[model samples]
Target chain A: MFGLIGNIKAVPGQRDALLAILLENAGRMPGCLAYVVAEDTADAEGIWITEVWDSAASHKASLSIAAVRDAIDRAKPIIAGFGQFIETRPRGGHGLAAIAPA
Target chain B: MFGLIGNIKAVPGQRDALLAILLENAGRMPGCLAYVVAEDTADAEGIWITEVWDSAASHKASLSIAAVRDAIDRAKPIIAGFGQFIETRPRGGHGLAAIAPA
Candidate 1:
């Protein structure tokens, strides 16, 4: 499985707005197994997005989806910067669901 | 639960080595719900460490644990630097086990 953990830095005081936008379209992700948007407790302006996709290709394909693109466009102005973008191969965990064809 | 998504940059060519070290002592963490270590497919020297602890206090306490401390010290040299450090609140998803008391 393809796993992604990204650090998103929102403009000061705009974290909640960005999170709402992320959660709004999260369920629409076609091949996404788990797309979790979490608030960073320590950083008022930061959030952590953890996602699991069937494959790297599926994740890439998500970008082309109109809804995803729109969300990105909508979120762009509030985003201050991006921190780390890393990928991982997932073995298994408690909350992670079984992998299915995306 | 408390969620942490951290960007770890390993020195060039040390990604695998760093992963091995991380995995070796992962299971021993107390109060840990999920601890996933992933490689960055886009960056040769990057890794994403995603962790879920029972609570913020648990995560903070983990740092003082002997094993965790030792692991950190051992892995320090190979660590090139840190990128983004963020925290999050986990709701629920697949593969993630039920939250059990630590």
Candidate 2:
């Protein structure tokens, strides 16, 4: 699975707004039908978001879309750094959800 | 961070229902300020969920709560297998969101 792992920081009191933006975008991304956002339960200021798209191509295709561009733009300052990964399970229990084509 | 990575399968033709449950619990989890969901980019049948919690204790505490228990109960039969991880980033380009104590 090609996962986008973004390191984003929440505004001191506007974390909820950032979350709303994330929810809003996740619900709308065609290529990204599944998007997950989580935070450091203790620190409240740190947030981590992991998202999977239909394919690497579909995810790339989404970058130019208005909604995506806007979300990123709105979130740019909030993000501390960006990390992206295209992973294939190497070992361990029942690996990731990289399903085979039908 | 103590992250729960479950290898849960979606009921045939009822994936949306599972997604709804995830959304519901995520919104209510006291220790889980962030929850993100994603599916395999190409395969329609595969799904992957990654979640982070306040602490191992907070996550464990949440499981006993009504919302979490109900989510698990309602979702267990649908799950194909389960995988749990308590991770300390071995190394990477800017690691996880494990914040320091106040």
- Give the TM-scores of the predictions, in the order they appear: 0.66, 0.45
Chain B TM-score (model 2 vs. true structure): 0.67
Runs in model 2 lying further than 4 Å from the true structure: A1-102, B82-102
lDDT of 1 by residue, A1-102 (tens): 799877789999898888888887665666676677777777778788888777888889989989879999999999999986556775444344445433
* Native-to-model Cα distance after best TM-score fit, residue B44 in candidate 2, in Å: 2.4
Candidate 1 wrongly placed segments (more than 4 Å):
A6-34, A42-47, A58-95, A98-102, B100-102
iRMS of candidate 2, Å:
11.8
Every candidate's CA RMSD: 4.3, 12.0
Q: Report lDDT (Cα) of residue B101, candidate 2.
A: 19
Q: Considering every candidate listed, which one attains the maximal DockQ?
A: 1
Can you list the residue pairs that collide in candidate 2? A35-B37, A36-B36, A36-B37, A37-B35, A37-B36, A38-B34, A41-B54, A53-B41, A54-B41
Q: Per-prediction DockQ scores?
A: 0.33, 0.05
